[model samples]
Target: MQRVLSCFFALFLGLVPLASADVEVKAPDVLVRDVTNEVLEIVRKDRAIQAGDTQRVFGLVQDKVLPHFNFRRMTMLAVGRDWRNATPEQQGRLVDAFQTLLVRTYSNALTQYRDQVIEFRPVRQTAADTTVQVRTEVRQSGAQPIGIDYTLEKTEKGWKVFDVVVAGVSLVTNYRGSFGDEIRAGGIDGLIRSLEEKNRSLETPQGAK
Candidate 1:
């Protein structure tokens, strides 16, 4: 669970943007760094968020974080080949449930932020490149720095993140096994129910779960 949380948090932390990365190829890398920096400051200053206010944290994530992500793509990648097996309705539900699960799971983890510094590794991609990897490192107090990388694709609106890698673990790959198991046990609907139940548990008070 700790590992999963760390990976999820790393996804957001790695998604921030940097103001200095003005070039097109480096845009996503810069964008994620800047956004992460902005979010860290918000977490550092907002008392309500620090106190585990789910609404406040969710609002921040929905407004500031979701816009930069390609949730459908992430969901599909996480589902792997099984994505094609699901009906359109199931795919939609899976996307929604998965997104909610991530939002609920990682929003509270934001409060753990405490002066963690992010360092962006240099990116080398041409303007014509449609996909790229933006790499970074998170330096935390009393802990070894962890590597966080984003896999983003260029779109009409901007560069949007579809996958994340934390400490060499691929976010989509991390869930592949569990997702497969759920689908095997109860089909696509089962996976959706599992995710929905998990989200509900997160919404519940600690005493309930």
Candidate 2:
């Protein structure tokens, strides 16, 4: 698993320490804690996990992460020029499959959450534009703290996190080029097939190890 993903998971694996649950939730703190808590609450009790109660990890990922993401925009960015050629149905399937792939990836990496702590940096703003960067630090006991920044855009409902940058790498940027290559190699269906194939090989993340 990638360090960025691992670091973020360690900070937000959702298992409330019980003692920490009653404390008042606040921003930077709440942003990191709440999302992690929401993710953990469902997976801890889910029976679908492969082992150590990881079966329902994918569902939990979809429920929590998907609600705050823009799959359509993600797909469009990933598909690049191929987006104009795909039919509405094809576009929909591609979005669904891509979403599944992401969920599975999260499920597989859930166990990477270790005994790490998180600190959210203040929201940075350079302009009045609707988009801004929200940053956080994932702190480890004996290791360096990893910086993870969420790129958020204002939506009709509220702020939605569209992309994540860990270290210097952008999750959306990393996948976008590859997805575009897939479209170029096999067309839209081929990309969809690739996503489905990867999802099939998914290993359920279990235990807290």
**TM-scores for every candidate against the unseen true structure:** 0.88, 0.75
Best-fitting candidate, measured by lDDT? 1
Candidate 2 Cα errors over 4 Å, as ranges: 1-3, 6-51, 125-129, 203-209
Q: What residue runs in model 1 are displaced by over 4 Å at the alpha carbon?
A: 7-26, 204-209
Each prediction's RMSD to truth: 3.6, 5.6
Give the per-residue lDDT digits (tens) of candidate 2, residues 170-191. 7777787888888789988888
Model 1, span 127-152: residue lDDT tens? 78999898988887888888888898
Clashing pairs in 2: 48-55, 49-54, 49-55
TM-score of 1: 0.88
Clashes within 3 Å, all models in order: 13, 3
* lDDT of every predicted structure (CA atoms): 0.77, 0.64
